[model samples]
Target: MAFTLLSRSPRLVICALLCIFLFSEVGVPRRASALGINYGQVGNNLPSPPHVVQLLTSLRIGKVRIYDVNPQVLSAFAGTGIELIVTVPDDLVPGMAASASQALQWVTAGVRPYFPATRVTGIAVGNEVFTGDDEQLKASLVPAMRNLHAALAQLGMDTYVRVSTANSLAVLATSYPPSQGVFTQDAAPYMAQLLRFLADTSTPFWINAYPYFAYKDDPTKVSLDYALSNPYHVGAVDPYTHLQYTSMLYAQVDAVTFAAARLGYGNVPVHVSETGWPSKGDANEAGATVENARQYNRNLLMRQVSGEGTPLRPKLRLEVYLFALFNEDMKPGPTSERNYGLYQPDMSMVYNVGLNQLSTTSAASLSLATSPATRTDVRKDFGSLCLVTSLAILLITQALLL
Candidate 1:
């Protein structure tokens, strides 16, 4: 009823429309049919999950992965058809491994309530544990995965959803020429066990492969064109397999594929859990620029659209979740760490990678009452941006009426 009256008041209506525009986005579909994007919320400013879903739907982007099982996000995505891959924070790994009940409890609380509607396709056990210095954490990885899988099986959600953990490319000790790829001595035994679990579970081996790191560390040696997936660069020859690699991203992925094959689990699918270039960086952090970011993402999108696969596994179309959806301002480390988003917190594109714009759509209002706070991720965000704007519009309309 208020919407009716507000629509009749030109000035008040203008304010409402402007505020909504400030909080929402509708995008044109990139040619990519199955591109996945990572949604990180480490900033004090980000659109709420509902707004984000509307934005992604407009762009026709389908898959998404979040660092944690945020209840707000899980609830908002209900019936949205967005396949979400939620993570179990690293700190919870030991508890999950120590007790099967703990894992079950996690699933009961984090997953069960929203699953069928949320389309939670997978649960990432813990990210990059092998690359960390914690030996206990590395040892606990498999048990945690097993217990979680058992919990899923117990609940009959096993077949409905997959179980796996994302790993750092650093887990590889040797990754040159593709064929020489091997897991580090420290990570080898664990990787062996992990790969076996994946093979059994029929899940994927998730790797966060970033060729930008290799180039940033040694730009002169790593061709800029190759690193950015530019098609014109003379492809490098992986002498052992002789599979030519025109893109460093593909080479890194193939390296992981080879590493897994060496471990006798070649049938296990290798997916890129996280990969993207930063739009800005500090002076010491080389190769982090807006232009580079645009090129990297644009090229990657083209590959996804064309259904291109790595030379090692040419038929299996790569399923990649780009590193981030927004530039998280509060993330620690170098400036580059905070600048990986395709859009700013307010949802403005950092640089267009051919993601066109279309007509507007309504984003459902967010209900923060159910969004529980977590000790692990205590950072604040502007998820309330739309709500605040809506209130402003209401107040404006009320004043005009008075």
Candidate 2:
């Protein structure tokens, strides 16, 4: 007969799990975090920096990208070992390009004070300067990036922090098959300069790609399951490359990659600077329900932990930064803009994307399962621990049948 005592006590199951991990022959190795979040603060009702830090730590989020180099945010992240990617706002880019000294001044005053302690890894020179027909701003984008990178070099911090800019998917002229992806005629001239700069500096090319917008615009034509990357969904196939894309995010990423490849800078890595689904939207906005938001983010997190990559670049696992940690009340945009957040101002989850501490544990376990090196001793670990885990599950199975 099964041990009734073990079945009755949940604490015993917890102890059993601890022993399995602590005594397993195959050691759990530390892996670099592929998950990152955007910590935007365009709202007044958001929590304090320290409180925000606590919330992020509780979720085991180690990397964050903020819209600007906010001092309070930086100070709060110090010694927490959370890597930060700070931005130099769009309005300030022109001035940084016009005068190199201003670039140095900006870094010295804004970034230097919190360096090393805060773990600032990258400085985004500007966010989507190519959005409007702002010729002057687009022209200054590379110069501002150069000046900022030079400023880092001046302070002997060039080796640590990388400099780049975030762009919108509007830069693409053709992205239908992904292989046909190319820069818009108007954006090409500026993008060429930006691509060369990215290649020279060895920094990633950042782009904000939102599949929700596509689904919202044409819900009848677009598959909601495919957009949300739901399992068993029949995805798209690029006619030219014949690459099978099961997720919209991967297709969008490869579209950017192919666009860069057309320009002869295919070697440069493309990072998703921002992507998320809004839990709420205006009456006209389709597929913006809370359930869809929960499904989208939950699936995205699963993809990251599994170390899944785009079909085109399967070996290079995609590095993505999810947008807006909290729903910002003061954000000056449509209803969707204010709603693309995992949490509300009160630290309550808008929709749980598995943000609990257990998610981190799950990530580690997933990594361990995928590692070929760990499989060598799988028998040894599973043999010893399967009994305990099976008993724990048997209780639930028996209860269900009872």
Candidate 3:
């Protein structure tokens, strides 16, 4: 006979769930721990670094990737227990490659001071360098990553903090069919060698895949449902693998897997370093609307919760860093460039994924606001409000006199 545990009361189940929310490690349930956020700060009016840290910690988000190592942010995250992935700006690549000691010094200065307290977990060396015009930078990318890894190894931080670099989809010349994926001819050799390095080091291959770009660039061809993860057409079938793909994002991911397989490093894991749809956009930038944004992220998060894998790796859950945490005002390009955030500068949700205020109330006791002694930024919120009010009064008096 099949056996089952004696049933618990409804009240007990609710209480058990509450305990899991407030006290579980990362407080996101064991299954959701793998999801991550990309914390880009190319804007002037974002919440103070401390508040940003608070917001992530309060929401129980465990993994986050910042585009650059801003010390203020690093300092703010100290003791917050959020696993941060820090980045090295492109200009530093040549220097990091020229000397291993320099790499060590850079890490010592940028990463060492905030250790167990800050929960820094990874270092991304020079993002998208392979796709840039700087030939010198492209050449230095792998060596720089290797030296940085070596430096971390020397400091005994390599085990916990891995070294990696993020790549843009531009690296691939043809990615539509998935199975026939191939890297750009000029980038092929370097990518092959880089794949070998990642395979040997057991590090993930980080790719910044954006299905929105595909849909926008060829609106006549790409399906909106395929891009937004709605019930849609069977998108494309990989000729070689014979796997049918239903969405552009999954097809994009499988393309990377196929490309790596072509290089004989098929076992190396691929992670999405950035992917999100904008809530607003210019007229010609089709598919960048709040509805699409909500659908895309909501469906993506649901798939993540299900622990589903790409067709290439059926059992392994795909790790993703959602494109951004805040809408960056200073980012160049079309209007869509600044609108990928899931939250606005004021820390309000752009699109709710069932994290309503009521559901998160029990979690409020575990919020960062409770730990005033641990972070001064939470306290600064009051100070900033006072300052803004004072300025507003001054402006009103001047207007009355005029």
Candidate 4:
């Protein structure tokens, strides 16, 4: 009897495997690249980080970038398997550069405990330090980065977590031709040395480029379609590189590429640290309408999934992180600056950009809120609710079967 049962079990397992394969093949959309979202919480009313994890998982976004090493965010991401890139805020640079001990202490307290569970893949030493007003901060940028890298190396986490900084396009001198790009005279030496360090370490050079700003600055001169990634019209070409570019954003990227090439670090990889359009803007902030924001982000996401690269680097897949997950009302900027979020503070998408849905009306949207669960909060309210509902339905079906 035991041998006969074993003979039938193999057939049963085969049938189950076939069913699982067929179901999955028919169900999932064939997205090409891994999707990553930025989870910035500059607002006070955002949801808890754990709940944000639930929302991101439901949306199938596998990676996230946070603006700071908030212990709460780091702790919440533990065991979640979401790859995170955390920041070392600009203000921390002075202190970190002053003391290797401080850098070590900060890393030990802020990063060490969450290892293996949190999957912190990258550390941004500072955001747009080159663009900041303080000359000391600018000088401190690379040193702070070096100190942090040393600290990570001491902890044996250097290979797993890369160290780098994000630069604003203000670092560039001429971005118009996209091929004739160069750093401001004062910044050239510092930037070149930083680029060398980045290249040596195999860390990606991060830049924040926004064509929206270009268009807003000179709408009459900038083609709307060109800025929005609309291929309605034939675009310009770089005479030097002979690269035919379609969008201002790509041109901006290639300009940086050429600039790095000029500085002899052409091989260094560049990543878009931030880019997005705002749904609302001050009246003078041209091209900041809701429709334009939707189109810009939708098209950007489409391009990202298509695995498209700039004309200069045709084979490399572009790694991009959209800016501001929530429209942080408190952020000091033109109205548009505060409104670039993909979602609102209340956990709803500012607009849909082709997320999957079983029912036509369902929203598989992104949210910026953190999770409410404490470290000890084991019973996830959302997960438990879903489980209880499933169990109740199962009990009902079993009673009917009886």
How much is the lDDT of residue 81 in candidate 1? 76
User: Which residue pairs does candidate 3 place in steric collision?
Assistant: 79-117
Worst 10 residues of 3 by lDDT: 1-10
Weakest ten-residue segment in model 4 by summed lDDT: 367-376
Please report, as a residue range, the 10-residue window in candidate 1 with the lowest summed lDDT: 362-371
Model 4, span 1-402: residue lDDT tens: 112322444334223322322232232222233556678887788889988887777766656899888889988888776778998888899999889998899899888888858989789888888877889988888888888899999999886778898899998887867766677776677888799788667677989988899899999998888898765558788765556878778888877865664565555668888888889999899999888888887777767656577776655556777776678877887899789987888889888776444113222222221222221132223244334434433433343343
For model 4, the superposed segments whose C-alpha errors exceed 4 Å read 1-33, 357-402
Model 3: runs farther than 4 Å from truth? 1-32, 231-233, 357-402
Put down candidate 2 lDDT per residue, 111-211, tens digits, no spaces: 99999899888898778888876788888889999999999999988767889989999899877777667788788878889989986776779999899
> How do these models rank on TM-score, best leading?
2, 1, 3, 4
Could you tell me every candidate's TM-score relative to the true structure?
0.80, 0.82, 0.80, 0.79
Estimate the lDDT of model 1.
0.77
Top candidate on TM-score is: 2
TM-score (C-alpha) between model 3 and the true structure: 0.80
User: What's the C-alpha lDDT at position 275 in model 3?
Assistant: 91
- After superposition, the stretches of candidate 1 with alpha carbons farther than 4 Å from their true spots are 1-33, 357-402
Q: Report lDDT (CA) for all predictions.
A: 0.77, 0.77, 0.73, 0.72
